[model samples]
Target: MRPVPKQRRGVTPRARLRVLQLPVVLWLTLVWVALWGELSAANVVFGLVVSIVVCLVFPLPTLPMDLHIRPLRLVWLVLRFLGDVVVASVEVAWITLRFWREPRNAVIEVDLETSSDFVLTVVAEMVSLVPGSLVVEARRSTHTLFLHVLDARDTAGVDKMRSQVYALERRVVRALGTETQRLPEGGTP
Candidate 1:
């Protein structure tokens, strides 16, 4: 008779989607408010009733991942990400107009410093969502992404794209992760 092997204890494959919890909860609350309309006795009762029904009807599945969020830091990260999105949108719009005049594009590879797959996914999604740039390919093993950008002409152009990707990465890490390593006081170690 053979002895059974032990499985290591850690985040399971189905437990990584803690990120969606906040959005879903907020959505549910909004739905309840809409159903209830203005705050009144009848509406309040109805909202609670609907909220309870909604919670059971659509329970989020675990994704075997942990989102160790620092609340204040998460707030800052969200603000930073939104600000970047607005700025990126304007830049993308300008790039689009330029491409309309003279279309020249290039695919540049950006290396991701993050080790978390979840953070990488979110960062890639945000980059892809912005108009002027698209994430062409993301190789997890290499932690590099291929991005196709409109109107990229030189190394500086690619560097700009790289900077945007890293900025998004920094926000994601700050929001959803703990810094695993600290750098030296004055310079990179």
Candidate 2:
């Protein structure tokens, strides 16, 4: 009997489709349908085909992420995020109107407690989506995110922003992180 050859480390032909996640493909198809502004069967089929083709042709960079999904925590996190979005939108609009002439902008670096890259990415994305702050740099080695914030007038304001960011990170960790990486109850880490 002949010995069998070892399988390669890279993705196999059958696994190519697996590289494109179901949620991403669905979202892409939805986007295509929305852009065309049509709800016909032909549109749905076309959108699905296009989404699949795009995903196959342009494969995304894979991140080896370790995710632990806590359903109840996730629900709470979503509700809190939505509320924050509304409040931040209003606050930022007010700030823009009030200080159109001399807006206080500052770049602040926040050190995150968790060393997980996935958590870091999630936190950065969430912060960027909140309107007034955008992540300028993320250093994985130091687990620090540098954000450019608008309307932070003074040192106290900057400190407050830092505190808020830390608080957000804490919440994110509590929502999705495993016990090993999560902050303690006393919250001194």
Please give me the total number of clashing residue pairs in predicted model 1.
9
lDDT of 1 at 23: 51
For each candidate in turn, the TM-score is: 0.60, 0.71
Per model, state how many residue pairs clash.
Answer: 9, 0
Clashing pairs in 1: 14-62, 14-63, 14-64, 15-63, 15-64, 15-65, 16-63, 16-64, 16-65
For model 1, the run of ten residues with the poorest summed lDDT: 180-189
Q: Per-residue alpha-carbon lDDT of model 1 for 1-189, expressed as tens digits?
A: 224333334645444333236555556666777765765667656665565556545554534456788788678867766776788789777866664577578899888876666777788887887767888898877678899987778889889888877766776666676443421133211
Model 1 CA deviation exceeding 4 Å by range: 1-62, 98-100, 182-189
